[model samples]
Target: MDKLDKQSRTIKFFRERIPAFACIPGCHDCCGPVLASSVEMARLPRKSEQEQDAALAALSCPHLGAGGCQVYEERPLVCRLFGTTPRLACPNGKRPAVMVAPALEQRVYRYFEQVRHVLV
Candidate 1:
């Protein structure tokens, strides 16, 4: 498969295997200062300068909408994997019944690195 096809498959598998719980109502504390690849950032909708400033000042993601994430479907793997990994568990104490397998997590990490490396 081509790179795009591989990326799609990887993301699909990762999302399916790594479950996420509902975040606390009206809480976006974890949305701040997230690191994402260029491809992931490109998928997100642009934010206004004022909105960007506010998000930066508040240390939150610029794409964090009033209701929730503005680009939920297109959100990066980091966003999708949030609250699933042990090191990045949800602050609200919500957790999935099955955690992502170590091998699967390693694959996801490889995907991230590959995407970033290819873009850069």
Candidate 2:
């Protein structure tokens, strides 16, 4: 496979492997500024420079809506990792019944290191 195809598969692998858990109703405490790979960003709605600056200044995610994450389904791997790993535990103490395996988490981090990431 080409580089693009490999990266795409890697992204899909992590997305599917990451476990999901119940979050506190109406809670978005973990929504904040985060870095996303170009591949991930392409899946999200565009935000203007002004909007990006404003959200960064406030230390909030540009995609965080009044209700919750506006792009929850398309959120980056880091966003999905939140509350799923011990390192990024949910503020409300919510987590999957089984935490992400250390090896898997490290592999995700390694992927992040290999990719070009930008603030989202």
What are the Cα lDDT values of the candidates?
Answer: 0.72, 0.92
TM-score of each: 0.76, 0.97
lDDT score, candidate 2, position 88: 98
For candidate 2, the clash count comes to: 0
Model 1 over residues 4-68: C-alpha lDDT tens digits?
66666766778778776667788766677566665556567766778777877878877777888
Q: Write the per-residue lDDT of candidate 2 for residues 1-48, one digit (tens) a residue.
A: 987788889999999999999898889998889999988888999999
Which consecutive 10 residues in model 2 have the weakest lDDT in total? Answer: 2-11
- Among the numbered candidates, top lDDT falls to 2
